[model samples]
Target: MAGAMMLALADGGSFTLEWTHSVEREDWRETWEVTEDHRLHLTEAAVKGSGAGMEPGPGGHFEDGWWVWAPDLPPVPALTLAASGETPSAWTLCGEDCTQLGATSGQPVQVAPCPDAG
Candidate 1:
């Protein structure tokens, strides 16, 4: 799952949403910690139901923060909210909604498509 997420992030124009469900007992104490390493630490927890939540980790940090939840939580397929590029193309955001930022494809594309052959 982590590898898949990394690939999505590499695109620099994608977002993911995950849902979870499980039983939560009173004794359950969920402690979702966001380490400086950018890895999610989903501590003790119990989903109980279709509980949905989204956490925005430290932004701008290419390698920082994470999202964590209890293991009991239901395995919700990751949702690709949006994926836009400089090219005028439609992206598949899956079930997740998307909002474009800035104007004119936003920033420039980093990589070049190698010299085109005539």
Candidate 2:
């Protein structure tokens, strides 16, 4: 499967990210690619979890920057990610207790600064 995220640029030149992942077809591992003015590419692959819903609990991990997980689900406010997964069509992140985070598409998944990186 394939998905994309749009990067809004001030110069009018937008950045785009493309990703592909699959469980059955190992031919294409879960990976993300970015393209923009700066010439750089990431070849490493990461397992894009294939699951759904939150697990509920304590602290967790998350990526940086302001993000919107799902516009359809309830708002989660500012917090850490407890669990995350990719469905057949979209990416989702949730707090430790698996509270609802709105549906996010064509946009950043974790907008706030990533906690795991720090």
lDDT (C-alpha, whole model) for all candidates: 0.27, 0.26
What is the C-alpha lDDT profile of model 1 across 30-108, one tens digit per residue? 3333223333334333222322333323331212222334353332223222233333333222213543322243332
Q: Model 2, residue 10: displacement in angstroms?
A: 10
Q: Can you write out model 2's per-residue Cα lDDT over 1-118, one digit (the tens) per residue? A: 2453222222112222222323322121211222332222322222223333322112322323211131222222222222233523232322222222323323334423222221
User: Candidate 2 clash total?
Assistant: 19
Poorest 10 consecutive residues by lDDT, candidate 2: 25-34
Can you tell me which runs of candidate 2 are displaced by over 4 Å?
1-6, 9-37, 48-87, 91-118
Indicate which candidate wins on TM-score. Answer: 2
Each model's number of backbone clashes?
7, 19
Q: Model 2: what TM-score?
A: 0.19
